[model samples]
Every structure is written in C-alpha cells, then in structure tokens.
Target: MHTEPTAQATATTHPAPTDPACDALDGGPATELCAPRRGRPRSEAAEQAIFAAVEELMEAGRSLSDLSVERIAAAAGVGKATIYRRWPNKEALLVDVVARLEAPAPVRTSTDGSVRDELIAMVEYMRQRGLAKRSRWMLKSALSQMNSWPELREAYQEQVVRPRRAMARAIVRRGVEEGVLRSDLDIELLCEIVIGPILLRTVLWDEAPLEDPGLPEQMVDAVLNGVAAPPPDGRSR
Candidate 1:
C-alpha cells in the first residue's frame, strides 16, 4: 500500500521578537506586524485557482517561458499581487504546482522486516507514478525547459527530489541495519539501482504504459540477489 510522504515541517507560532518592546503593551512592532495584518489570510481558493491556471496553460501547449505573472493573475481571477505574495516568480509557482500533483507516495520501511518486498513495492510505486499520463507530460515539460530555466530545475530538486531521495535512502539504511543488505552498501548507489531502470525506460526512451507486472519484483531481486546462477545442492559451482 502507498503512503503519502508526510510534511516534515509543522506550522507553529514564530519565536517572539527579541526586542524589549515586544513585552510591552502593544504586541511587537506595529509597523512590522500591522502591514501584513491588513490582508486576508491566504485564500485556499486563490491557491487552487493559480495551480489550475498553470496546469491548464501547460496542457494547452504554453511553455513555462511563455507564462507571466500577469497572465496567471488573469487566469486565476486574483490580483497579480496575490500571486506574487505566494510565489515570487513563475518558476517557483510552477515548482509548487508540479510538486502538489498526484503521484506515488514514497515507500516507507515495512514493519514486517521484509526488505525485499518493501523494495519491490517502492519500485512498483515509482513505476506507476512515472508512467502516469499527467506525470509524463510534466516530466517532458520540465526536461524541455530546464536548460533555459535553471531555477526551475533547482526548485524541482529542492522540493521533490531531495525528499524522495531521503525516503529511499532511509529505507536502504534500515535494510543494512537489519542485516538484510550488506553493511558496506552505498545507500545512494542502492537507490539508483532500484530507480534507474524505470527512469531509463520511461524518461529516456519515452516508453509508454510500462505494464510489466513483474518488473518491480524482478528489479528488487536483481539488486538484492545476484543474477548469477546458484551452486548445485551440496557442491560449489
């Protein structure tokens, strides 16, 4: 079963100001706080509208370079200032939109101690996500524009890649700790071993509908158990 990656950060009150006046009558500096207090709390309606606008534009064949703050503001029916307040630029907005899209959840370590099974499940989950129609389009869009928009690439790496990699690395580390995998294994390399083939087939080759039901299990087996034939019963090969 797939479980969504939980938010690592929690929203709590910011630390009280160190300024001595903060402890006095009026809370903190009015000049600093009152300015923001005037606006409505960020509207979820506006946020979703903006995300939909970007996706709709992309689906209509507009590249990221073709998008502008004004255009998005018009599309979302919110003021340009609203968009700017949430995302400083189009690249940042697109990164967030893509990040929030429905995709396979990261695979967490299983409690049953079956590392191989967990690895297979993760591979399958990633495969499903990568082969999804919307995901494929998003990947294509990102790849085509990433060369010209370095910040877009950076945002993607920061928001999506790092968290996913962290989850994969953690699971690999757990395998080593449980003696299911070799102690000397490079966690990063192990992660690539599991994800590399799917990426190669789907992204590099544009292979569609990656429908091999056994692919995930086969991949995990190849990584955990060698491809070499086993020795005959009672004798070393």
Candidate 2:
C-alpha cells in the first residue's frame, strides 16, 4: 500500500509515471502473453483505455488478479467485445499488465574506472530495487508459491533475475576485457556471487532491512573484495 517511491528495486521509484501513464503491466503485446490479437484492426483508443484502466486499478489499490475484464471494459468506457477481442483471458491481460510495469535492464557504467565502483553501482541498483514496494512483495509471494508451482519461480527469474544478470555480466565482461578485473574469474559465477547476497538479504533471508544505515557499502564490500581478489603479486594485476 506504500506506493510512494520507497527504497525497493532500483531506487524504489513509482511516482505515477510523469506524462499520461501508459499500461505498466504488459508482457509486451497480446501475442507474447498468448492473447491472439485477432479480429478487426483493434481499436487503438480501446487498447489505450484498457491499459490506462489497468494502471488506475493498481494505483487505486486493486491488484491484477482482483480485476476482471468486465470491470476493465466498464472502467475504460469500452465494450466487453472490445476487451475480449484483444485479450482472450484474464491471465493474458494480467501478463501484459505486468510486462508494462516492468522496468528495462539496468544500465552498465564504466567498469574501466574501478572494480569497486562497478560493483558498488550494481549493489546500489539491487538494493534500491529490493526496497521497492510492489517488487518486494512480488518476490516474497513468488517464493511462497515456488513449492506448489515452480513457474512462478521461472517467471521471477525471467523477468527480474535475467535482466539483472545480463547487466552484471556486461560490467564484469568489461572489467575483464580492460584488465581491471582478474582474467581467471568466471563471469557468470561472478555474476551470481555479486548478486546472491543482495537476493539473500532482500528475498531469502530478509534479515537485513534496507533502512539499516551503511548497509549498501557493506554489501558492496562483501561481493567485490571476495570475488575480485587481487593476484599473487600481492597487488591487483
């Protein structure tokens, strides 16, 4: 319910997207979510209206599964036929809704600077994301459902983890290529090492609260100083 930009998930931002808010809950388009966009050249106005309604519903304190197509159509001032034409089912609609809300992959900064700085940025990004309102809840909910249904786990990995890994991989790769990072280290392994603690703190353990002062720096040290250990020369090669 605390929708204001808290500290979860990449700075915990969510101030009702500036400009006229678009649907933040899409899995891309209807096809991606398995909603056949068949029929006439669907009404653009209708689609926008539905997407907007989705945003409003969430902002107004309604969840994805809690909403119905009938309610959405009515809220958008459109017809049931128009709603059903694009989205075959509520799940597909919800998928699209989630996709819309999803943020893009994190941006990689110059690792050529220092391994310390690169990793600090990565941890900061994860820490901020962990502090987000909906994202934090979503992660906790996913783990709870992972026992009965594993796809929720996969969905979380696909949507959240994969993008983050890609970002971290790039940073690590850049460091290695520039000789700023040790060449022998496995980048993927490094990726897991870098992010595992953040996930543990944020998702699994939930021991370290984001409000804890100086925690971000501690996290950065735990990852960097461990993985990017200097070579036998007793200095970073």
Candidate 3:
C-alpha cells in the first residue's frame, strides 16, 4: 500500500532546474546563452583558392572581361555566395588580385634612413616589381589592359599610384626642408626628376633593363648631383 509512487508520478512532482540567464525574455524554456551567428565563418583556405583560381584563369589566357563569379567559384570549388561575400563584384575581386600581384610599397622610417636613402629604396622597389611583373605573363597581361577598364584603372590609381606619389612628394619635401635638395624647384617637379627615369623604365620601356642592383643608387645620386658638366673655371653653371 505504501509502495513507492509510480515513476511517472514522481517525475511529475519534480521539474528540471532552469538557468535564469538562459531563459527567454517571455519566460519560455531556457535557450542558448548567446544567439547563433548569422552566417558561416570565413575560411582562409577558401580565399586562397579563389585567388589562385583567378590567377590560373588569367594565366590560361582568360581575359578579365571573360571572367565571372560563377566561373571563378567553379574553378575554386566554392559557392558563388562565398566569392560574393568577400567581393561585391568582379571588378572588386580583380582589384584585389592585382594588388596581390604587385604587393605593397616599401615603407622607410626616419630612424632607419635619410630622405635620399628612402628615395633609392622606393626606386629599387619599383625596379623589383617591374622585374616580377615581367616574369609573370598573367600580371603583364592584366596590367596592359588596366587602362581600358575605367573601374580598375581608377581603383589602381587610388589604391596604388596615389599613395606612391604621396610618398615621393613627402620625401622630396623633407629633402628640400633639410637643404638636401634645392628649394627653388617645385616639389612635384623634384619628385619627377628623382623617380621619373625609373618609372619610365619600369612601366614604359620594355627593353630597359631592371636587373642592375646599382641602378637605383646611380639614379638618385645622378639626380642629386646634377648631370650638367662642370665649367673649366669650376664655377656654377
């Protein structure tokens, strides 16, 4: 008669404990402490795959105009949504690819070097980049077509060219202030005088050699010391 109550009766008598922190606002059953994230986490492997796919396509003679998110995704073995999540469109993706190929410009600190040394470093960086681009057919082809693509061209100017020009200007300005360079010349003109030859060789003259490691130092020194020959009297020209 006094036997233990049925298991179902005992279970009904005692309820499971609940955590107040996990309870919903409406006082419903306890939920997870935090809401689940909305989307999948980014994967580095996937990103690298996408970049490789783009490069491979370009290397295979596929023009940027012919590339699409769908094609890239298939080549990369990822969903189109993955590429879209990272880049809004094909142009944006291509910009990143170009940037990866070119790499970042060198940065020099005041404590590490002088303005002349910085200028030499900048020119050397361009020389190396030119050599690298020449070695890669894909990069060469992509860069050759950049001018015709307005979006890509503008982005390149904003992201790469502008920053480099600004750096050159800063260095030139510092040189002028320190009396290392002539203050009579315009800053822009001075910048062109310093880096113009290297830029021309790198971007325009395909036959120009960039293999000479001493070329940067020679260029900087020549510009600083002037190319004009000395008069017989050893007086200023």
lDDT of each: 0.63, 0.56, 0.72
- The residue-by-residue lDDT of candidate 3 on 165-231, one tens digit each, is 6667777887899899999999999999998999899888988998999999999999989899999
**In model 3, what lDDT does residue 179 have?**
92
Q: What is the TM-score of each candidate against the true structure?
A: 0.72, 0.54, 0.77
Report the lDDT of model 2 for residue 206.
59
Q: Candidate 1 has which clashing residue pairs, if any? A: none
TM-score of decoy 1: 0.72
lDDT (10s digit) by residue, model 2, range 1-237: 111112223322121111111112223321132222335454555666788887787677665546788788778777777666666566545545554544333344333456667666667656665665335454344235445545434554444444445556766677677776677979887667667777777667555677654675787676556656678889866
Model 3 CA lDDT for position 211: 92
Question: Candidate 3: misplaced stretches above 4 Å?
Answer: 1-42, 109-111
Candidate achieving the largest TM-score: 3
- Tell me the tens digit of each residue's lDDT in model 1 across 94-175: 7766655535454343356477776776677677766664456765565568778888887666545555555566667778
Q: Give the TM-score of candidate 2.
A: 0.54
What RMSD does each model have against the real structure?
11.9, 10.1, 18.2
Q: How accurate is candidate 1 locally (lDDT)?
A: 0.63
lDDT of 2: 0.56
Give the per-residue Cα lDDT of candidate 3 at 119: 84
